[model samples]
Target chain A: MLDIKNLHVKLEEEDKVILKGVDLKIEPGSVHAIMGPNGSGKSTLSYVLSGRAGYEVTDGSVTLDDVDILDMEPEERAAAGLFLAFQYPVEIPGVGNMTFLRTAVNAQRKARGQDEMSAAEFLKVIREKAKTLQIDADMLKRPVNVGFSGGEKKRNEILQMAMLEPKMCILDETDSGLDVDAMKLVSEGVNALRDAGRSFLVITHYQRLLDHIKPDVVHIMSDGRLIKSGGPELALEVEQNGYADLKADAGAV
Target chain B: MARADLKKEKHEATEARISTLNMPQGGTWASMARNEALSRLRGMGLPARRDEYWKYTRPDTLIQQDAPAAALFDSLEPAVFDSVDRLKIVFVDGVFDAAASDDLSLSGVEIDRLETAAAADIHWAKDVYGRLEARGQTPVARPLAALNSAYATDGILIRVTGKAAKPISLIYTHKSEASDAILHHVIKLEKGAELTVLENGPAASRFNKVMEVEVADGAKFHHIRAQGRDHERRAATHLFTRLGSESLFKSFTLTVNGALTRNEAVIEFSGDNAVAHIAGAAMGDGAFHHDDTVFITHDAVNCESRQVYKKVLRNGAVGVFQGKILVKEGAQKTDGYQISQALLLDDDSQFLAKPELEIYADDVACSHGSTTGAIDQDALYYLRSRGVTKKEATDLLVLSFMAEAVEEIEDESLREEIVTRLTGWLERRSG
Candidate 1:
């Protein structure tokens, strides 16, 4: 479902390589977790995949479902069934959450030559999905992420991912600000959306979230390169014995 | 010859033909006012670009030698207010249409033509007719006021006695077949009276001039002026309002269509516990130019004022906003806020906003801000990504910008009416 070949990205002004000769592939029906320390280019990789502004793709290419997405704009990438759940969702004042969500969903539908959803239909679907995520109807009526609590904002992000139903989902540090209960609820939301034809790349600093949504493959990253690839037991080992041992191994390599 | 000298020569020629300008020869007061207006017109001359207030709005196109003093009233048409339930006073080419107006008997409210009322109620006319004359002389000079004072043959005079509920609609229509034309109006609301006035101008008139209001002690006044005109027509209006103790004054001006338009409103809070709200929106396209200048004075303690102006400029249009709030000494506890924002839709469009606040009183809350920028690209993209077309996205953003001002309107029906008109304007632009 997703492929990145020898991808190298750098900052525009400094020319400092953030993602250096990284390669990854994920087939449909599988969940992959990328565990990394600080400054390991986890967010950078997500931005590069989502085509955010100011990140230059200096080398290699990225393809989603055999379609090259490096040249697409952010909205184009979004319309092409690629979704990125931001670590810090933008706070857009004066724009209601429901309005923004409906616009995003309709935009993707229109891009795929599908009929637009009416306001009533959108309201019904969103209300039902919001209940499962513990988001109140009133919160959905407020401006997007404006004055929202940490847990509520994270839940809102999951609500959006549920509404969009992208083919490939990238969760960038989705577990950073969540409490114990919130982490479980968010993981449940992700697990509910799992299917045979969908794929997910969950990025995190801690292995706690991995306990809820088990991944088929776990990759340890250090200094912008995947240092180790193993099974779900790798996450438990890293959680028990920190990344200090992994650091020594990476240094020797 | 220099341009100034040529302009002076043109003015002299226009003055020579003032008498034979083919205006109707009505009653004694009308003739007298016309004669005095001719002399005043000769003395003051036409407004030049050098004048500070007229710097941006030059009156050269209105000073043609063959320009008739009286606009042709034969082709004048009634407006949409004909179906409304309020009392309608019609003014064609600055003259009252007594036969077309309705005769409603309301206690404590006096509605009559200015020229005719001067004979019956001389004291009232003398007290408030030229009250703004002394103040219009210096600081910011208004040649249009001088011209209107000199040439205004007839206008509508409304006086509400105490706490009245009904509203008054003044309909002024200008119809000109040959050269440009002008119409001036003066209105006064007395102490303790509450009233709403709606001023609707001609849809395709050439040139119209107005100097309209005065508010007395403890009164509340609401003024809404809607101007829609053709690309060749020009319109200018100056509205001056004075609020007394515990009084409230609100004014909303909407200029949707015009070639060249200027609307200036000056509000003075002369007594304590007074409040003023001034809001306006201008929509321009093609070469249409709309300029709005507002000055509000907080003279007494516990007075408050707010001014919000928004403009949407498209095609090759230009929009300008100049707003100032003045806090006088000893006017403590005064709250004055002003904001002016513009949205430029096309590359050829232009917007200039200048917001100023001058404070002398201590312990007063005063602030002013001005912003000129294009629509938010992210917001637009977000809307478009929702399946809304590009035009729909732009229209929604523009509507939201103008909605801030429209929401300030107190009347629900009137607010909805303005929004409908705004949507129509956006639709026309999109098409």
Candidate 2:
């Protein structure tokens, strides 16, 4: 459902290259996790796919359902069923959480030429979804991400993903600041949306998240490319023996 | 060349401007008050570019010999506050329109036109006509307010003895392109009484207005004003209010689409344990210049005052804010908070702010802050990434930036009206 081939990205304000010739593909109804150390361009890959600013895709192509997404704006990409759950969700001081979610839902619906959701209908759906994530009415009423705890932020992102129901979802370090309980709650929320048509690209530094939401495939990214691809057991190997040996092996290759 | 010659020239120029205005003919007390205001205006002269308070905003358009011509705007949108139940008082081109206004009588309150009340031999309005405006001139000179007090031709006088049944709505409609309108309103709330006043619409092409409010002990006063939507109209408005012991005063203004507007609010706390809040939200696009100058003084023990002002400007628009909070000696436990922020949508827009705090009370808590910034790009991206268009995202951010000032409105319906207007203003400029 998602494809990235020869993705070579460099910082727009600098000549330094981030993602150099990275390639990955994920099929429908599957979850793929990318494990890497710091500065390994894993997060950069997610940002490039989401069309974030400050990066120039020098040479690469990304597609969702065989439609080229490189030329689309961020909102267009979103309307085209691309979603990125930010690691650090932005703190908007005055935009209420409910208002933001409703606006986003209606905006995407209008972009897709579908009927907008009514306020009553939206409140019903959000309340049910929020219950599963332990997000209460107060959290939904307050400004988006303002004064939110780390776990609350992560769960809020999951709630957004649930609301949007995108064809492809990219989670960039969703487990970074979350505790064990939050990880399980978020993993359950993600697992609930694992339908036949949805796909996930989970980028994380640790395998603890994989323990909660099992991945069909795991990739070990060393420099700017995926050096190894294997099953869930690969995560165990990396957990026991860190990326030090993997880096040496990739360099030798 | 010398200071004396400069003063004499300024005095003569002010007199020339005054000679062109037709003072409203009234009875003994009203005429005396107008004459006194005239002398005060002469002493201060009209605001000049060299004046410290007028440095950021030019006073030329406000004090010019002839009112500059402005094209009338035909708005298809319904007037704000239409949904609320209010006593409507209409003014067309600065002249009171009795036929279009509601009955002047309301339970628990007495309301009369300034022309009629001033024509009476004895009236309660005589005590408040320009008293607060005169008191507001100390430590700073507001010659434009003095000019309005001296030559105002029409207004309303309200005295509240009990809780008002509904808000008194003063609607100003501009019908003449070159109409230079001057109006002064006086409101007196008796002990333990309460009242709310609503003002809206563009009065005229060139408008000067003053409102003086006196809140007696334990009384309450609320004011919400929306400046007219005529894009080429110019206005200078002043609100002078004094709060007595245990009284409460709150005022808010929303300004949209004016060529130039200067709104000044001066509040004084005279009795212990009083509270006052003044806030404004302004949006200006091309050729728009909006200014908000506020001075709040805490002179009684344990009084609280807040000033919140926010402005959104784009396409070379300019916004200025000069807010000060003064805590006098022996006014222990006084609390004063002031914040003025501007969101510049583009690099071409400008925001100039001067926040000052002069305190002599060691036990007082007074804080002031001012900021100018562009739209938060991170927040914008977060919104756009959620499938909202770039324009919509920017508008959301702008609204969020101004929400603080808008929240100062206490009434839910009034606040909603202001929010709706804010949204409409953003939508109209999106094109």
Top of the candidates by DockQ: 2
Each prediction's TM-score versus the true structure: 0.80, 0.98
What is the per-residue lDDT of model 2 for residues A90-180, given as tens digits with 9 covering 90 to 100? 9987789999999999999999999999999999999999999999999999999999999999999999999988999999999999999
- lDDT, candidate 2, B1-431, per-residue tens: 77787788778779889989988899999999999999999889998777899999999899988899988999999999999999999999999999999999888999999999889788998888899999999989999999999999999999999999999999999999999999999999999999999999999999999999999999999999998589999999999999999999999999999999999999999999999999999998999999999998888999999999999999999999999998899999999999999998889999999999999999988888999999887788788888989999998998899888888999999999999999988888853
Tell me the tens digit of each residue's lDDT in model 1 across B346-405: 799888776788889889998888888898775564454333456766776787778778
- Looking at candidate 1, what is the lDDT of residue A154? 83
lDDT of 1 at A123: 90
> Candidate 2 A-chain TM?
0.98
Cα displacement (angstroms), candidate 1, residue B255, comes to 3.4
Best-performing candidate as measured by lDDT = 2
